[model samples]
Target: MSITPRAAEPVDIDKYGPYGRPPSKPPAEARKQTRPGPAFPNRIGTSEYPAEPGRYHLYAGHPCPFSQRVMIVRALKGLEEVLSVSILDPMRDSRGWALREGEGHGLDEVNGFAFLSEAYRASGFEGHYSTPVFWDRTANRIASNDFQHLDTDVATAFDAWATREIDLYPENLRGEIDELNEFLYEKVHNGPYKCGFAPTQEFYDTEVRSLFAALDELDARLADRRYLFGDRITLSDIRLWVTLVRFDAVYVTHFKANLRRIADYPNLWPYARDLYQIDAFRDTTNFDHIKRHYFGTHTWINPSRIVPVGPDLDWEAPHGRETK
Candidate 1:
């Protein structure tokens, strides 16, 4: 059932890097953490320009962990009115990120191009084709292709225009959040990739070890807190959720990060379920999209390219954390 472009190859990582525009909003106005504590490095890349409603359009694929970061922020900040977003077709066939003419793929609602890669070039972004791209229509150029900091932009920069005040990176948690964020990113977030895309066995072994070490540690950490911090969720949760939700569905099976399923971890399971129950994160998750893209696309892993169908997950079951 493996169905991505790399289904025939074991692990065909054609290219690596965050594929998207540079950054649409500039440094000062775009990324300000509402949380009143220590300042975090600008994770989201910034552009040379300013924030303008409707001037920039976001492009993302729900299957992508990085893209989900931005989507979660957009929902939390209530920037649906101030900014626009386009969910691209998950299935891409070389032409890349295009609608199947009618197979649920819509004509480019923003730039009117059939392929997203083309749209990137159309916007003068010749670098990469990764997701969570911010397109600046006015300049006819990519504002910021960096996917990491898109959340920072939506959360703080748009506060003036947004209908609600949802501060994800609150000041009080900044100090602690900073330390945990580093841990999550290095060992958990990008660890699987290091395992999957490593060129040698030694590389894979190192990455897999680091990856699971972080997970085992995180499982222990979650035994006390409902979220990454106290009772409330923040950007820290959003970052880790992107990887955990995809772990059992994609990494466990494909990347071979099979030490333990997110389901196997007691606290982590409930934490993921709690987050999955949220509309913004839930609606953005597509196990099929993630599965097909990884197993099928990374031909280097499963050259046979047969997608599996056995991990029946019931994310809907109530997690008892709410009562705690």
Candidate 2:
């Protein structure tokens, strides 16, 4: 028996064009490509996975800031070859995401998935289609979607396969990285998400307060140091960098996370500029994809799904972080 391919329908949900109520459906059920993976459980003792040249694959959607964190860490660690990557379309429908047209994704490059949701199904999950999935391909299933762990896997676990040994997570700076990453996530990473996807005004209000409060603290902190780690870039710096890059692009107008723009923040401006100067950050960033994904796909947020233009920034100019 053959399962006939369903004919593609015009993308009619909404593309964030402007405000319009979505057509009747049940009380809003957040459509996920797959279930969100569980957090890395704390074990009695942990040992780093033995670093190998070719043992893992990183499955990601490029527009995902969480996924970008994993991508940046892999590059900074010089493990591009050690861990192969496959890109899924940032724009997905109810059926879940597939490779963008002519994007030439290897079918389930790790687990041979035609669609990303299959991995979640394979993992026996019934959650959301999340990004930055770490798969142990030889085992033929997802090792984890623990993005924070993704960095640890690349930097600490696969140190043997690392080409340059950049060590984004240095021993002396581990304390600062651990502390700031938590604060940053509360304020910025999931903060914007909570604001945008929030079901009620009260929730959005509280999240908005936390989001800006953290931004103010980060701006003050970065005013003294070159990077968050006091000069050199670290995993923590990279994590914040991905969010800052997207703040103006979609967070401000759409996510309603807009207390202020990155341009308006004093220290944040220079801090972002320094990260933007990095080869990996710039190369991975695409304003088009960033804008299109959130604005175009999340119909509940932006009813019309029309893309907006005009928050142009100056990321390339001289950022005086060195003098700070």
Candidate 3:
């Protein structure tokens, strides 16, 4: 469980910083240009990357919502002992997400790569380095960084090895889950980024409005049910909870997603707390990483790089959700 801390490999700080954007380019431009890493077939029965305990590992950062989603599913499905994980340091310098010497910040045990980008390069990937990487040790290369598919594959593909019987993506609910996921991705998952990284005033204005409109609709929908689909916590709930958990603490100010705090919403606030009470969701969330990453790394937005200290959250407080 312990990893020796070493200096990260040299990289072009300017080129790799700001999420792999050139200094001259706007944040929005970077968002537009950055593409998800290439996909790798990792199904349970597939020859490429089969479901085998201790054969695969997940490279993740606690601050990343995408990574958090995969981690949540891994825990919920009881794949923690089956699939290993190495968490990167929250702050990404020019060298990108590094493995600092410490207890929580773990080095790349699978490949011993100091920088995450090095792992990408070793796998013959020249694109932007992102986390939630699915590493297949038997092949000595990254299996996938396509987070959306990666999340589901980790949830369902390892059913044979999973200890828990909980199914987040059931066959009967696929249609409903997919529909809700698509809408949430555009409006909630990626909505805050669109607001924070807007290239112009016009763009920010448009995105913030759209983001709030979607939030309003979601809040109304949750007014009756305990979760998105019904009483059970599905993939839709996991996808949306990651965003909501960070909304008041980071997105409200840093991302300018301030139409209203998630706390302001009647149903959404309690719903978030209800999910937070679950160990799979709460334990994966690292507010320290979340706050530091946004405020420290995004110097273009927060030039002073000063992380705020207020906005205290009581996620463990009674949600009163059972009354509904």
Task: Point to the candidate with the largest lDDT.
Answer: 3
lDDT minimum window of 10 residues, candidate 2 = 26-35
Estimated TM-score for each candidate: 0.81, 0.84, 0.90
User: Tens-digit lDDT track for model 3 on 1-324?
Assistant: 454445464333355665443334475564453344454534533666777888887889999898999999999988899889889888776678787655456666666778788777888867568877888778878877877777888878889888888889999999989999999887888889888877778877988898999999999999998998888889999999999999999999999999899999999999999999999998898888888888888878887879999698788989888856
RMSD of 3: 3.2
- Kindly list the per-residue Cα lDDT of model 1 for residues 1-324, writing each as its tens digit: 221221111122344311222233332222222111212122222455577778777877777787889888887767787678766666544345543333222445666555666666765445446677777777776676566567766776667777767678888877887788878776788777666656566666767887888888888878888987878888889999999888888888777788788898889999899989998788767777677766665555666657788589899989888854
Q: Is candidate 1 or candidate 2 better by TM-score?
A: 2
The candidate, 1 or 3, that scores higher on TM-score is: 3
Ranking 1 against 2 by lDDT, winner? 2
In model 3, which regions exceed 4 Å deviation?
A: 1-45
N/CA/C clash count, model 1: 31
Tens-place lDDT digits, model 2, residues 5-65: 2222233344323223233322223221112345432211134334556766777777888
Candidate 1 weakest ten by summed lDDT: 3-12
The alpha-carbon deviation from the true structure for residue 89 of candidate 3, after best TM-score superposition, in angstroms, is 0.5
lDDT of 2: 0.71
Total clashing pairs in model 2: 15
